[model samples]
Target: MRWNAEFMSPSGRVPFIKCGAFVVSELEPIVQFAANKGVTLCSRLSTEEKAEMRAYMSLITNVLVNAELYISWLDEETFNAVTKVRNSSVYPWPLGWLQTRAKRNAVAKRLKALNWHDKTLDQVLADVEQCCNSLSQRLGDRDYFFGTPTELDALVFGHVFTIITTRLPCRKLAETVKQNKSLVALAQRVDEQYFKRP
Candidate 1:
């Protein structure tokens, strides 16, 4: 198989997954892969649970992640203070500025298409709070979304941790999770469980 593509891209892609010559690309298939392998990722997903996971992923992708992007790249204070500082640390000027502008524009256009452009920061924060509350209600002090660690937990934790810990200048969105002790604990738990560096 000719895999002639960037191994990764700014679009958040891993070119392929090679598991002993078998390959899957993209996230959903990776979920399917775990199900096929009887792995914990999707092993216990009932029909309803699968549906719920997909729905939550959709909301997270469109709403939670979008809000983070908006707050990070579009908000001037956040962009200049936190986003630019961190991005410029890893990416040189002009390139960093150019890429940040591009990504910010892309996210802005997407949010505009979703009619989120007109939304006030308070409105955005409200949406984030709603999302956190919903997840908390579903999670309810559990170790994971389904009461056990699964790919869904990993997926949500990835975004939440990044958003919360990045120290966004505005801090409203980050505070949404911190204000919710359960959400904060969930991200912390996922980190301790899966991302230990020792």
Candidate 2:
């Protein structure tokens, strides 16, 4: 909810990181920046597997991210209940209301540009299902997507875990993720290893 930080970001978004004087925003650029600094998680993966990883990552971004925007901003129930409150929490008075409205409008326009604005809730859910299906199939019985934790795994965990855990008015999104056992297991593994302490 760092509203001012988001505005300060070069990309005008959250999830930006600063390493000393270098600042990187967005996931792919962050990953690339790390790689340039001799830090990489996919070093052991073969070239073809890396390509597949990128494909799956693209799928998650195109499908799951759009669905999230749809649910968070365009879904009236969720906007009125959750997003508005959380996004506007940093401000007071009419400023909070105005900022939230402007943010929602921007999201609506972006969704429309991406052709995701018109999808029904069910359609958006279906897109999420398909994305999860691809991820599950790729993961198979592996602990991660490529026998090791890659960026794809991190990306998947970020989105899937949030969907399942966040308190949404519509439970269908979480339910869809839970339906995929493999994906659920992946999320559980990531959560336990990275998020939970012994």
Candidate 3:
């Protein structure tokens, strides 16, 4: 289940290339959830929008699966080290006996520039909400999109999970998702089934 990290870095690939393996590993439970919801892959919408959503959703799901596989391969020490580095501004490891502060600063500046987005956090959240709401409206009271749980459901579910779990600035959207009973339930189910194991 090896993945190309460079390919996974892009926003478009993040959901699918990184997340697809996770979905596959937890396919049984996910399928059960979909069955309960009566979601079908073949949606009722016309050609264009349906196709577009399906493509986006598929990419997201693939990424989630890949991420799951990556995490599973990490040992406890590695996991803790990664967690610490993510939580703290300071580097978790020694940079070498004579590393200079200026060098570190230069690296940080480069990384920040690489991650700079044109949109603000609020703007990003708004965009996510718009997509969710549009899909939800299309979904109506049905448990899932289309007739059964398709790639879209898994991708949407994984995105909600990442939103809640990560320290990204757009956490407001994640909090909002928590307020959605259906979405939260889906996230919980997916996490419990796929991510609960050591």
Candidate 4:
């Protein structure tokens, strides 16, 4: 699995990439393209499984991703302590500070547009709990979301692992994740099987 990977800055946008100068950005189209090309990421997904994967992806993106953004930007303590340093870790001092502030403002505006900026931390975390619970129930006793290992597992991993590992002063979301034992083990299992970097 030799590949080039770039760490795109956190700018309140979706991840995207260039394939031989043909740019593809959004997640759904990228996934469909891969599936159409019989790529490894989606080669094994059946029609039903693909639908399930898309459903889960929507849930995670809408619920977990937004909750993460709200916490990282709107929550005062997390912004000052964790998000600020993490989002700016790559750039040098003054530039890093400026970049972080710009990113914070962008995320704040996006959240406001989504009507999420005004919610209290508790409200946001309550949504996190519901989302996690729904996902956890869907994943009970299974190694992956839709049976065998697939892209859905990978997408789910991104959020659960991120919440667990993020160094936020506010840990409500992480705590909710911990309350679900299956998610913890699912992340650990996937890390061992798919993401080992030795």
Candidate 5:
């Protein structure tokens, strides 16, 4: 299921994982599930460090994710030019139209709840830039958030990579991300070390 993956997800979101007979939705839950299975990344972190990581992760989820949703759904130009077409591409006619409308409405509601629905596109981009700035400060000169690869690195890489590479009607988001050299460097490092492996 390409566009239909959300239908199978317990939370009606994409990027859910199925391990054997069990299903895990969302990144944090999936990471916790993996940790429970002995696949640990932040095991060496101190309790305080772990708490800080969680806070940063929450910031990313609240800021970056909301910004992405706003761009894809709330921005009229992007919604009309990219999101609507891509979202409905896998379906035919009336169902596609129905699904796209529903998804857009759901995203709008979510953003509204987060107080992001009323923000202008410039405001959304500013939020993304501030998010990138915070992440960059945390990272500083370290190659990773904790001086070692962890779930935080993976999470940051996933969002930053998508923002940079994705074709969008508005280039401001990508441009904003690119303005942060440290974050871009971190993304490049992850891409080189992990994704480049054969």
Candidate 6:
């Protein structure tokens, strides 16, 4: 089935998928970065921390997968809006306004059953730090989980890229990741591999 009128077109899905693929490809680098930085692993996490990590991972994975699937169904206007966000050179007001409105309406309806609320930047950063520390520990010296690409890698990469590359408040995570040589190398490798010009 095609995307709804509110959603963007198949072409719009290209950037979204490309972004996701880039993140998926960077999983190993992030793990390596964590190892070098002495982050704690899942096995080492306190029971509460481990639970939080699992929940955080699950939330991120769901967002990435849903975004991938949702983009596949977008119509023209929705597609254009997403492209505008990615390009950023455009005047972002109308586009951002429209996108935010659409997203709020949709999220409000879809998440009505859940106790959802906006989080402060500090809250988000704290959560991110907690998760990064946990995952980094589990990733010691591993090139990839299960020795290959996995959905977890994709989710982590996507969040890291968006949080790091954008002017969003969460860009500090990118800075933290960069502090580790391994993570920086991994991000560079992924950029060269997926985001480089043909």
- In candidate 2, what are the lDDT values of residues 1-198, reduced to their tens digit? 455999878999878999999889999999999999899999998999989889998998899999989999999999889999988889988899999999899999999999999999999988889888878987889888888888999999999889889989978889998999999888989999999978
Candidate 1: misplaced stretches above 4 Å?
Answer: 1-7, 10-26, 33-40, 88-93
How does each model score on lDDT?
A: 0.76, 0.91, 0.49, 0.78, 0.91, 0.46
lDDT by residue (tens digit), candidate 1, 1-198: 332232343235554576786777766777777668876565567989978988888878778877877787778898888876665555566786776677678778988998888888889899988988887888887888887777678778887898777755586787887777887889998889879899
Task: Write candidate 3's Cα lDDT for 72-167 as tens digits.
Answer: 222234334443344233333454212334433443454345442233444444555555566566656666666465566666776677767765
Q: All candidates' TM-scores?
A: 0.80, 0.96, 0.45, 0.83, 0.96, 0.46
Error of 6 at 95 (Å): 9.0
lDDT of 5: 0.91
Tell me the tens digit of each residue's lDDT in model 6 across 35-117: 55575344444577546545656765444333322332232343355543543333366766576556545654443333222
Worst 10 residues of 5 by lDDT: 1-10
What ranking of all candidate models by lDDT puts the best one first? 5, 2, 4, 1, 3, 6
* Best-performing candidate as measured by lDDT: 5
Candidate 5 residues 13-81, lDDT tens each? 867999999999999999999999999899999999999999999999999999999989988899999
Report residue 75 deviation for candidate 6 (angstroms): 27
Model 4 regions lying over 4 Å from their true place:
1-14, 40-49
Model 5: colliding residue pairs: none
Runs in model 6 deviating more than 4 A are: 1-59, 62-99, 108-118, 176-185, 193-198
The CA lDDT at 192 in model 6 is 70
Q: Which pairs clash (backbone N, Cα, C closer than 3 Å) in model 2?
A: none
Q: TM-score for candidate 2, please give it.
A: 0.96
